[model samples]
Target: MCGRFIDANLRGSDSELSHIKIDPFERRFNIKPTEDVLILAKQSLEPMIARWWLIPSWHKGGLKDFKLTTFNARIEDAREKPTFRAAWHHGRCLIPAGGYYEWTGERSQKQPHFISSAGNEETLWFAGLASRWQELLTCTILTRSANETVNDVHTRMPVILNAEERDAWLGGSDDLTMGAGALLRHHPVRPFGISDHGPDLIEPED
Candidate 1:
């Protein structure tokens, strides 16, 4: 599951949502769940800042009272899962990420790895779902079985969207995976604390 990732400006002026201003978007390293994130939902031209964790629209309790693991939802059964059912049909969104972090090995010796684009691409748009808990906007990334390279570290990875698939995805399309996995590349990185912030965190470790 994708638990951590990086966020930066939405690069490439020619992108589908490039017309929208993302200046308020912050550059974050080691971004975790329960934090604010940027997302572009259906029928919206402006980018929104949403919580990394999704709280279903049907939830009626206080934020602290609800407890469910919804940071990532599996595409295979999200539509059937109660937590993600509402979002699956009408809450489609696009999550902007530079890349994501994955851990391998045992708990005592977990190794961190950064997965990013293997091409000239500057941003990776993850397929996501958005929901509004009252006035609070929240989102979650979608996942599928891993591809060849990512399988070496984990069995599942975020369903990243290519430029061609972005518009269709936001339009409530189901065929989200369009060979986008092949564009990925990953490498080991130095361990870092949650408070650490900078571009160097993504740099390769010896």
Candidate 2:
């Protein structure tokens, strides 16, 4: 589950996300759930800002009313879960992230790690689900079993999509064959929890 991540320039790229230009997306090294996020939803040529948590369209209560952890939806059960089902079937979207954070070891001495693409691709597109509640737009990142690069620090990682998979995902294709392998890299970083968001936080610790 990606509870926190980094939202930065990521060296720029000409991939599918090159067209996504979100204003005031100022670099953030410590983005957390419930905060505003950048997402490219289906049927839209431009990206939009959305509450980083998924709020079901059927919800009529206040935002604080629903607290079932909708920020990160598990890919395995999202298709059936009430909070994400509708969005999963039709509101699929894309979220771009420079990298994400994961913790390992004992609760008190947990070590944080920053994980990003192993290749030259700087922008990593995350398969997400978007929803509309009242006058607000909300979204949630999808998570799948961790691959070789992330399993050591966590059991799950966000559903990462390469350039080629963008069309299929936004076109409402759940048959996303994530392929037999994943290309990713991880390195230890200083622990900052939800406090510091400085760029230096991503620097390798050791």
Candidate 3:
């Protein structure tokens, strides 16, 4: 699961959602669940804030009901999962992220790896699902089986969306879902994950 990620854009100036003006955000190298984040929905290019964890509208419980993990919805099961089906079909969204973190090795020897776009882009847009609960907007990132490059580190990775695929994903058409599958493949730029942190965190480590 994508439990941690980096929100490198502290200034809204570098935002991909430039169509709509956004306020500056706190830069976070290690973002956790339930944090408020900015997102772009299919309904509009405007930027909106949403809690990272999704709470389905049908849920009867209060915030305490958030115990069920709804942060990462597996792409394969999203359509079938009751918790995600509604949002999957009607609440599709784009989540901006610098990169995400994953761990490798046995529990005692586990090491952290940072995954980002293969290109020099500052932010990676993720395919996401969002829903409204008690006037609050919440979302979850979608994940698929890992591509070859990141398969060694973990068997799963978030579905990273590219420019061309963005419109199709936000299009909300069933046929586009089929096309979106092709984009699910690993990025072409050789390296997938780096093992260290620092200014070069997004770069592949030797």
lDDT for 87 in candidate 1 is: 90
The clash count for each model shown is 0, 0, 0
- lDDT (tens digit, per residue) of candidate 1 on 69-141: 9999998888889999899888888888889999899998888999987766768888889998999999999
Tens-place lDDT digits, model 2, residues 100-183: 889888989989998888876777788899999999999999988888877888888888876667777777776645511457
Q: Over 4 Å off in model 3, which ranges?
A: 8-16, 175-206
lDDT of 2 at 136: 96
Question: For candidate 3, which ten residues in a row score worst on lDDT?
Answer: 182-191
Native-to-model Cα distance after best TM-score fit, residue 90 in candidate 2, in Å: 2.1
Strongest candidate by lDDT: 1
Candidate 1's TM-score reads: 0.92
Q: Specify the poorest-scoring 10-residue window by lDDT in model 1.
A: 174-183
Between candidates 1 and 2, the one scoring higher on lDDT is 1
